[model samples]
Target: MSDRDASTPRVILARHGETEWTINGRYTGITELELTPRGEQQVLSTGKLLVGTGKLIDPVQLERVFVSPRRRARKTFELLFGTESELAALNKVEFTEDIAEWGYGAYEGLFGEEIVARRNEQGLDTERPWDIWKDGCEGGESSEQATQRLDSLINRIRDIQRPYMHGEKPVDIVLVAHGHILRAFAKRWLGVPMGSPLAMMLPPGAIGVLSYEEHDINAPAFLVGIALPLEEK
Candidate 1:
């Protein structure tokens, strides 16, 4: 998502690979789970494609890595950078709960259909049903709570990149975490409201990049389908 000598800093968001819960569409938050075997291979492939001396994620440009504390997310980091690879030796990696999946609480293992049924059984309002963006999980985090934590993290990232905005600094960073929280993070990155409906998606094991427009920190925007051009012979 960036050049090794990029003047503009960018944030890379990487979702962990598939787990059993991911396949079953279960609300997996806080509860730790390992990546499926296929998931492992998927991450390995992604690493080869994106991380290298001249790739989208040039290791030399990585200022820091914010990863979920969950095992699955950590495993992805290991695979992406390769446990013994020099790139993996970068010293600023942080395993934090702030980027962890949205805490599912009572809906931790429940599917969407099941959550609605449970809410109905408990005599809760079903007219609007169980829209996580709106209703949120009963015992888990409210949209407000998610916003607070993500906003804090976003501020930190911006602080790191702000001074280096027009300078030649390797200020790019990566976030390794679950799907829901990363998506929420993206929303907050663009100053979008939490309750706003999100059609953007970062599927399991997918990579996304966000950055400022025209090197202006005041105009943060999501970077999509970015491709570096071929050099002339």
Candidate 2:
């Protein structure tokens, strides 16, 4: 791990490529849908832009990768890295249920408006439109549950990073999953409340970067953008 530079460790949150459900505004939880034809192209282009030896996410510096087990997520991981056999060589990739898409249960595959209508008919969220962050999904994973699992992942990442952050060996972690969970993960990373109104977006195949502020473990923050660390040939 001696290849690290003076900068702090980084965590890359990558949402999977477009899907039928995503384009149609469906809840898309636990349905195991495939990415659309354009989804594959989207991820390929992203890999070209953001992943490489000197790119934003240099794979050699990656300490660990956490991917959701859903097909769309797996496909994105595969597109970003390689096939299953190729990924085995990296020894840092883990496809886990902990990062799976938020389970919508009865609300799975329903559009937002449709979910709101049904919830209203059921005498739920009657006063206000259904907000997944606030009301959560009926018979599905709750905001608290999302907080618990995401916090566990964040702690695990911190454990891996805390001891080595200042060392010469830099470290990075990658999280590939669906829209809602990744957004929730970002909130949890900063110790934010899961039920807080989230006004962020990570469109398909988009990547968001996160890092500790001022090399302090307690001060996590979003790295929205920065000038490229370019070097002359």
Against the true structure, whose lDDT is highest? 1
What are the clashing pairs of model 2?
1-169, 4-170
- Per-residue accuracy of model 2 over 42-92 as CA lDDT, tens digit each: 999998888877778778778899999999999999899877534458678
Query: Cα RMSDs of all predictions?
Result: 2.9, 3.2
- The residue-by-residue lDDT of candidate 1 on 139-208, one tens digit each, is 8899899999999999999999998887568889999999999999999999998889868888788999
Question: What clash pairs does model 1 have?
Answer: 1-56
Error of 1 at 218 (Å): 1.4
Shift of residue 119 alpha carbon in model 1, Å: 0.9
Off by over 4 Å in 1: 1-6, 85-90, 229-233
Least well predicted 10-residue stretch by lDDT in candidate 2 = 1-10
Q: Give the TM-score of candidate 1.
A: 0.92
lDDT of 1 at 153: 95
